[model samples]
Target: MKEGIHPNYREVCFVDLSNGFKFVTRSCANTKEMIEMEDGRKLPLFKLDTSSESHPFYTGTQKSVDTMGGRVEKFRNRFARSVK
Candidate 1:
């Protein structure tokens, strides 16, 4: 990789808005916001609507689609008259 052609990869803070969970990691993502850390250091802050902390899959709050009571039944009912 060329020296000047590469983006600056540095430590940034990612904050989960829903749960207020924060962690520092290296990233090349651009951010215009800054957040002060515990040690009185400021870093680029990236805010996320949903992360692993509040995500349905990770939190085990995922809901299954009830096709049997929804579109599937409606589709069958609509087409059943045409088939018969």
Candidate 2:
């Protein structure tokens, strides 16, 4: 609860560069850009290369290694002969 020792925490607009998605949230991240919202409020703009909206893992576009069915099967076949 100290004064004049904490970074300025305020509402900032985050934009996903890949998908052009914009959202606002409170953060202490330093930014040099500004964006105007639909409500006509100008806020600090923070650009992101990847966000939950466009990330492969969050959008279910990432392929799993086990589902590929080749690398794991090859490893198992190689080890199966050694075990026998």
Candidate 3:
């Protein structure tokens, strides 16, 4: 509720560097590159590695760990032996 004490919040475009995907959202972050979007306006383009389009958790492409597999089970068995 204070005035003149907050970072500038404006519409900015987030560009996924790996896949060349672009989306616009409000951000207080800074960037040096600017690109013209489909709307015909130049927005500050921030390159990122992971976004909702490519992130494992959001896209549901997560790599499942084999917790019940051979190596893990062997480790657990060894730990149980050490404890006993």
Q: How many clashes in each candidate?
A: 0, 0, 0
Inter-residue clash pairs, candidate 3: none
RMSD of each: 2.6, 3.2, 3.2
Ranking by TM-score: 2, 1, 3
Q: Native-vs-model 1 lDDT?
A: 0.93
Candidates 1 and 2 compared by lDDT, better number: 2
Model 3 TM-score, all chains together: 0.76
Candidate number achieving the greatest lDDT relative to the actual structure = 2
Candidate 3: list runs displaced more than 4 Å: 69-73, 76-84
Best-to-worst lDDT order: 2, 1, 3
Candidate 2 on 1-84: residue-level lDDT in tens?
989999889999999999999999999999999998999999999999999999999999998767646887889977997885
RMSD of 2: 3.2
lDDT tens per residue, model 1, 5-49 = 877899999999999999999999999999999999899999999
TM-score of 2: 0.76
lDDT scores for all predictions? 0.93, 0.93, 0.87
lDDT of 3: 0.87
Evaluate model 1: give its TM-score.
0.76
Point out where model 2 deviates above 4 Å: 68-84
